[model samples]
Target: MTVDVEDYFQVSAFEEHISRGSWDDLPCRVEQNVDRILEIFSDQGVKATFFYLGWVARRYPELVRRTRDEGHEIASHGWSHIRATEQTQEAFRQDVSRTKALLEDVTGDPVQGYRAASYSIGRNNLWALDVLQETGYRYSSSIYPIRHDLYGMPEAPRFAFYPVEGDLLEVPVTTLELAGQKFPCGGGGYFRLFPYHLSRWAIQRINQAEGQPAVFYFHPWEIDPDQPRQQNIGLKTRVRHYLNLKRTESRLKLLLKDFHWDRMDRVFLEPAPSP
Candidate 1:
């Protein structure tokens, strides 16, 4: 299992609705929600990777430390949640460097993983993988193979592959193929929008039929239904963000009990299991 350790306000969905200038003044709730997540993982005897934003780490060093102390892998979600497609290569490099340094400093371990904000490292910005490689990251889960409005590389490999030859491993989010089209089954809204049985079936298909591990992801705020919702956001964004918030935690509990999950590094970085 994996959790993006960012609050509801920092999400890309509300980037336009809520300005970064007003971020510090907002009510902080990631700590409490993440605590609940840790407790859930603890109860299930599961370990997960938490890809956190650098800005949050600066304010909540104790939260980062607490996550590390709980034995979960600490990874980067960029310095300010900036999408790679919106930044130049040099800018992306600087962002990754800053985030990697901050995460390593906070955890006292080599930060080996990265998941781009909004999965924005798509075809136009595959160079982001090169930047990640040069910045010393071992793997990234930034690209989603299915097509989407904000981000995707639909024709990309569904399972783990090295996008930059040998420098970095690109573990695109999980997808299920049907009628020759790739569908988004990785997690996030798809997990919320669809029935639990659908996600369960997709992962089972990936494991049994495709013979690969599923890389599912969710956010800390997903389990927090009462989180302050922004009113000025677009109707589409509001619906996608707010739909099924109350059901997430319960579904996650069932997901954990049903499947064996581990950090991205261990699952992809390690040798492939014999087919």
Candidate 2:
């Protein structure tokens, strides 16, 4: 299991609704939401990877330290949450390096995993893998294998693979091909938008038929239905961002009981890769 540690306002969906300069002025709700998530995980006896935003970590070091104190893996979500496709190689390196340094300083552990904002690492910018390896990330769950307008390398491997030939493991978010169509089974808006049974069945199919564990992800903001509704976003963006917010926490609880979950490193990186 993994939670992207960012506030409701920090998401790429709200980029047009809010600016980076004004982020501090908005009510910072991530701490409360994450605290609730941590509580839920503790109740469920589950540990997870939290992909921390460098901007969030800087403002909420205590929150980052608390997650580490509770034994969750702390990983980088990049500084400012910029998309890899939007960043040049040097810019990407600087972002990851800075976030790694900050997260390591906060948690005092190696920040081994990364997931780009909006999963922006795609076919054209494959060089991001080399930058990740060069900067010392052990694994990345940044690619979505399904086709998407914003981000995906649809032709990428569904399971974990060595994108740079031995260093960083690229663990694409799980998906399943059924009825001659691909659907996203990995958690996010997809989890909320689709019936829980469909997700459950799809994940079961991947596990039983494909013999691979699915990597599920969600954000703390997802559980916060009462967060300020971002105004002025386009209808499509609004629905994708706001759909089923209240159900997220309960759905997550069911997911925790339904399948096995662990940090990205433990789930995909260790135990040796298949030949």
Candidate 2 lDDT over 71-186, as tens digits, reads 88999999998889889999999999999999999878888999899999988998998899999998998989888877888888888888877667888889998776667899
Model 1 TM: 0.97
Candidate 2 stretches with Cα past 4 Å from truth are: none
Candidate 2 to native Cα RMSD, angstroms:
1.1
Clashes of each: 0, 0
Candidate 2 weakest ten by summed lDDT: 266-275
**C-alpha lDDT values of all predictions:** 0.89, 0.89
Tens-digit lDDT track of model 1 for 40-93: 999998888899999989889889999889888899999888888889999999
Q: Which candidate tops lDDT? A: 2
Q: Count backbone clashes in candidate 1.
A: 0
- Model 1 residue 24 lDDT? 93
Residue 68 in candidate 2 has what lDDT?
91
